[model samples]
Target: MSKPVIIIGAGGHAKVLAESLLRGDQTILGFTDPDASATLFEGIPYLGTDAIIFEHRPEEILLVNGLGSVGDNRTRQAMFSSFTAKAYRFTRVIHPSAIISHIEVEMGSGCQILAGALINPGARLGNNIIINSHAVVEHDCRIGDHVHISPGAIICGNCTIDDMAYIGASSTLKQGVNIGKGAIIAAGAVVINDVPSYTLMAGVPAQQKHQLQGGVK
Candidate 1:
């Protein structure tokens, strides 16, 4: 008797999330997209715009923006806020193929953990976080809200990644490090110390390059 769920987007990520929901034994009530003209995706219908969610008032729904890096993620954040204001309950989506350690893990709502991502025990992932393919969050790490751990990144144990931080592909965070809010670690950067807020750090050993103001690079 799993609750019925509504998917918010109809793009590639939505397709993957839908499959994960199905595998989790949740009933997917189809997707809502402004551009939807097709009858269905993966055997589920495209149910017009997002207004249908308010109309239907399903007991449980998961909203996901399938767009890749939606222009600094402002749009996705707004949508998430709107849904929260509307009293919609969001659920986390974890792919069945992912390997989660038996140790304590706290994952917030609307998290999408992709296949091959390894979440070790004692890790805490905040709301709307994306642990992308092959990313590894070692034990005792705290990942803040809306943080995106890109593919192949490795965060060592006891690290704290603050809200809206982006860990680029193949980057590594050393043990007990703190990455500040809205910080961007470039691809292949190796972090050994604390990264300040709104800074963009890159290269091996991760030197600070510049500061970002209000998501502007």
Candidate 2:
């Protein structure tokens, strides 16, 4: 039997996660959000705030990271790390319609692969990664922890996306490119070269815009 799951956010992404779990025939216990004012999220109850997590033992429920990232993933990364330290277990939520073309594709805990996403052979994804709707992860790609490949983003073969990096919606990364840790790729940007850590890259042929500090998420 699949374990009951609880989501940690109450946003649009959290609703999507709830639907994905239902499609997989998995039961969701509901969600918890400190800033949520609604009583229900897509028919699931709001189970109070962060303090509710303390009420249940880690082994009794599985947690799913429901927070979405536009460019910064520090919040998502921190939450996952914090819950993990408390002995809470997480599981991947792969939409039923997603295509996994290769047996060599490895995904870690708390990863979310949305519908229409294609993960080709030789793609390795680390913990808490998000391969969003219709995103394509080509062969021989290495994606680090807390990385978010936004909707329709295409990562070419042999590309390396480092930890906490965010590839914006519809962005395309050329083959053999290395994206540094915490780098942000803007929407519709086409990257042909390497991006440095904590840099913001944007434009047609992505160029470094400026350096970002810790709080710019």
Candidate 3:
């Protein structure tokens, strides 16, 4: 929460956050990406590899987790944990257009509540979370660390989404459902029952299609 911030990745998600930040007084120092040519914006300078972040002291600047997570969040989670271990705190990116019904909710660090997203009362969100554009988190939902609630995803009331679970775009979770750690819900899936850890849930009324691997459980 400072004057200037450095985005950790250069991608579509990074650009979206950049536009929102630019609307306010938030100054983007630069972005770190391995491939500089991939940077789309003209103004934001391209900082070299992610290692370049160490050039600045942790207290002087705030960092943003610009890495977008689809179904897997291990890479994003790792990046955040590495910096947090060194006492580098990531800034919260709450888009101006988002609607939050509760002010007393427990929201952890490095979370992005994006444009048009709606969070109802009693939602406790954990670190490195992305409540993507137009997504809905209903009352009393418990969302854990590094979770990616994709664009247009609807998480119903009293749902408990454990750490690193990926709720895909346009997916709907039934009330009181529990999505275990590292569970991957495919796009448009309707999750009615509880999904276990490292499981791949897909289709309407989501079925456990396979046991997922390479996920951070």
Candidate 4:
């Protein structure tokens, strides 16, 4: 029997994850958030703050990282890491509408493949990654840890996205392009070349706009 899951957050993304779980018929226990009065889908119980999770015990309930992403993923990554350090296991949530390859695609823990996403064959994805609604990861793409492919983003064939990178909504990457760690591709940008680490890129042809800091190695 699969373990019952407790979603960890009460934000918009958390609600979406709940819907996915419900659609898939997974066992859902409840949810947790900082706000004691937080409400969830179908009136799922508010199980108090994150501190209340200690009562459940790691071996008993699986965890789902329900935090959403606007760009940076450090907080989400940190949440997964902290829970796993205490021997907690994270459950991967895949929406029924998302399409994924049946072969040559390896996805790591805490991955959320949301509604309307299409992941082509031979793509390898890492931990705590989110392939948001309507995003397309084309053939043989390699995505590193904590990467978020925002809604409507298109990653072309054989692209490499390094750790903690964020592909903004509606952005398009050309074939074989490489995105470096901590890089942020601004919304609607079109990328044709390799982007450097810790940089922010924006525009029709995507140019480096600013330098950022602190990404996973």
Best by TM-score: 4
Clashes of 4: 0
Best by lDDT: 4
RMSD of every prediction: 2.1, 1.4, 1.6, 1.8
Candidate 3 per-residue lDDT over residues 65-174, each given as its tens digit = 99998788999999999999998989899989999985657789989999999999999999999999999999999999999999999999999999999999999999
- Candidate ranking under lDDT, highest first, comes to 4, 3, 2, 1
User: lDDT of each structure?
Assistant: 0.81, 0.90, 0.91, 0.92
Number of backbone-clashing residue pairs for each candidate, in the order shown: 0, 0, 0, 0
lDDT at position 171, candidate 1: 94
Model 1, runs deviating above 4 Å: 38-40, 58-62, 65-67
Model 1 weakest lDDT span, ten residues long: 65-74
Q: Clash pairs of candidate 1?
A: none
lDDT of 3 at 63: 93
State the lDDT at 90 in candidate 4.
92
Tell me the tens digit of each residue's lDDT in model 4 across 185-210. 99999999999998899999999888
TM-score of 3: 0.96
Alpha-carbon shift of residue 148 in model 3 (angstroms): 0.3
TM-scores of the candidates are 0.90, 0.96, 0.96, 0.97
lDDT of 2 by residue, 126-181 (tens): 99999999999999899999999999999999999999899999999999999999
Model 2 lDDT-worst window of ten: 35-44
